[model samples]
Target: MLDTGCSVQGEQGDIPKEHPVLKSEKEVLEKVKLEQYQQIASARDLTDEEFSSLKEAHDTPPSERYAMGKYRLMAVYNICDTTVVTAQWVADYDNEHEKKVYRDLCVLSTSKMQDGLNYIHRMEQLSLSYSIENTFEARIPHKLDDSQYIKLKYAVDILAACGFSGPFSNDTVTAQTLNDNVNQYWELTKDKMQHTCTTLGLKMPMPKKWVFKCQLGFLNMVLHSVLGMKIGSVNTRRKMYHLKHHPKV
Candidate 1:
């Protein structure tokens, strides 16, 4: 009699290898026609009013569309945990906007800073390679230097207002807090900030400070309200330890 294990292995080894069928030109053409028909059917099914409404909605700008989509998604999801969901939403939205803003700011700031540094580096290279008198005399005008300095100062101020501080704080804040604070801040002073930044030609950093403040507020809310965790405890650990040891009240 054949061993059961040997028979099973033999059956497994005899598994069929089925190759995927490559579509012919005729098949491809038929698929294209089918897709086109589906599209036409979908378009034809829509009423004139529906089509107009869809077109109007589509015409809305991306920023507005993003806002609408986000709110609609939130309404549809209706997640029970407001804290987590709201935080996630803020984080997602901020990710899209903040990433672009921060990246652009970094690029612009780094480019200008690097350019200035490069000039200094080049000057150093020249000084090392040849005497100062022998090298081409290229000096940054005091006015231009002063203007750049002012621009940098303005940028730093904008950054501070936006809430960008340093590494330690930014990572700790929740997205919900970031979103709420940013929206509030933006609504209150966006136009003013824009005008000021444009006038000064300053590159603003990411709003780290706003994020931190919002996060702190959220943490306080969670600690005091939701979780009921207090900041200080009067030997609660000792009380629990005694209760465990004594067994009776």
Candidate 2:
């Protein structure tokens, strides 16, 4: 007989009443909320400002929480990666003068790519310590240099011209130029680089592909979290739907 952890005193029909697994969704959500509160209440290191923000999130409706409170949690835990955040905020600003000012404040020198190259190198080393489950735990340098950022944004177009071949695989000198920064930053062997990329479910582009994907992923988050865009196209639900067959359209 399988030794079920449930008490033998309870009859089979009564088991669902007491079993935590069988609880209603409302009950489960309440339990989770209570546990979060307990953890926050017991935390010794939370500052007054951090506690206030967390408490505000806790009181917020499930549909209305900011970045689902993960940003605040990361901030409190000292694991927040601000590199992409700084870049995004700089890019997203509407006022040109303000954007320039913010970019100058957050990013390194515009003339030199060395700072961005160094940042990528440190991030690559940091990723070795990250597990698949807690990959975001690696604390990277939170700033970038302008030249490298522009190169990263335009790399997709360059890769497109090369018939979308893997990074550094295309023989064109221009295509190979894209990999030069990566090559300079890489301290490990080619085999180790390939292994790291494979383990992370990443392409051969190493840090470029990884960082590009991260920037795109953050944009997706903003679309869904801030703009309330769902998985399917909103155009499909309209009265006069165009390109009804293709969701990608």
Candidate 3:
């Protein structure tokens, strides 16, 4: 069974033989971090540590509600509500999109992602090291440190926005194709999001405040854990985002 004996066991901070979902989460987390590094390094110089700090925001959940490999983020933008987004539409979307995905005619539902988030919240409340937390926290990015929390981490964005909806069939999705899909979606999503932001006043994301906090958090982890440098004066506030989902997301 996919659920039987599915657990996350680790040494100090590393998990050996990670669950499949956790493996996917880790891959996406590292991938996004690396992509952020390249972009920042291209614009300016950075050290490994500096890059890690700056990479805190790139492709982050705060910046994008829906992007690559983010299943739980499908309903990122708060464009509509469940009252308007009926279950029938969601059902139609699930059936229609899955049936003929090549048309890019299918849209995502924030309600679906919300349901996932709800389940994740329940799992987390029940346990800290819950296996679900590995994938949930990875997809959510509620933390800015290396506490095994790979947030905004998954293939939902890249797969949905490009591979699943683009001009290719599932049979042709090879490594090269997936790579191409990711790049293509990255460019296209930026343009679409910018347009939406400008026209709809969707509140430009990734404020400077977030970057600073993420840097602080990462540094704090390094200090308290790695170098044992507990300067004790740093106070961090947890910023939360309420995931709003609409059927058209």
Best TM-score among the predictions, by candidate number: 2
The backbone clash count of each candidate, in order, is: 6, 0, 14
The TM-score obtained by model 3 is: 0.18
RMSD, each candidate, Å? 29.6, 16.1, 26.4
Looking at model 1, how many pairs of residues clash? 6
Global Cα lDDT for candidate 1:
0.37
User: Could you tell which candidate, 2 or 3, scores higher by TM-score?
Assistant: 2
For candidate 3, which ten residues in a row score worst on lDDT?
A: 146-155
Ranking by lDDT: 1, 2, 3
The number of clashing residue pairs in model 2 is: 0
* Alpha-carbon lDDT, every model: 0.37, 0.36, 0.35
Q: Model 3, 1-249: lDDT tens per residue?
A: 477865566553554557676789889997876564333223222344644554575555432322221221123322223342333333334333233221111222223432433554455445555546565445332333321111111122332433342211222334344445445554554445444334322344544553433433332332222212221221232222111112222
User: Candidate 1 vs. truth: CA RMSD?
Assistant: 29.6
In candidate 3, stretches whose alpha carbon ends up further than 4 angstroms from where it belongs are: 1-118, 121-141, 146-152, 164-171, 174-180, 188-249
What TM-score against the true fold does each predicted structure earn? 0.20, 0.21, 0.18
